[model samples]
Target: MKAFLLVGFGGLAGSMCRYATSLLFTRAQSDFAWGTWIANVLGCLLIGLIYGLSEKFQWLTPEWRLFLTTGFCGGYTTFSAFAFENLKLLESGNYWTFSIYSVTSFAIGLLAVAAGVFLTKM
Candidate 1:
């Protein structure tokens, strides 16, 4: 489908850009993971903008939304997805659920990555 092609192109470009940015920051000796944080924040903002625009203007093709939000933003930062899911919980007025989701996602995600790294080293 045409939308798939757009998503593919966006994914390719977004991935290459992410790789380049990661290397650029690491090479520049930037302190901390400013690169990741920056990427996440920018991705979040752009996704927000995209979502806003989507709601504001339904005239745009669905392909554009898929390319930018699903492809570019998805490739750029999964943090947007994470944040949005949490927001869904908050929106339901489930503050306790939000806290549980927050702690569990962070803790389990970190642990899982560590476990993966440790296992793959074998």
Candidate 2:
């Protein structure tokens, strides 16, 4: 519960920050997907830091993991989360699940992007 709120609040903050950062960059950069990539990378680094710190300091609880890992990281990234989960599964020798998840995620992500682009043209 506590973790949930922390993650929720962090997500809200992260999302707002993502938008603001994009707006700022769009004014100056104007290259490609600066926003999405930035958010995803930042979220990934943050999650990694959180996990590393938790492991090092033993400061993470179930609630904290829920809040930081599931909540904040989730709000920031669905793609990275999928990759991380699949990687962990495969690393732990769950090859079948990893294979299924990897294929599904890649297929869905590609199809969804295609569909979104097609729809946007309409």
**Best prediction by TM-score:** 1
Q: Which candidate is the best by lDDT?
A: 1
Each model's TM-score, in the order given? 0.79, 0.72
| TM-score result, candidate 2 | 0.72
The CA-based lDDT of model 1 is what? Answer: 0.80
| Predictions in order: lDDT | 0.80, 0.76
- lDDT by residue (1-122, candidate 2, tens digit) is 56667878867766676677567555454668877777777777877788779989999887777677777777777655776687679779999988888898789989999999999999
Question: What count of clashes does model 1 give?
Answer: 0
Candidate 2 stretches greater than 4 Å from native: 1-7, 27-31, 116-122
Clashes of each: 0, 0
Clashing pairs in 2: none
What TM-score quantifies how close candidate 1 is to the native fold?
0.79
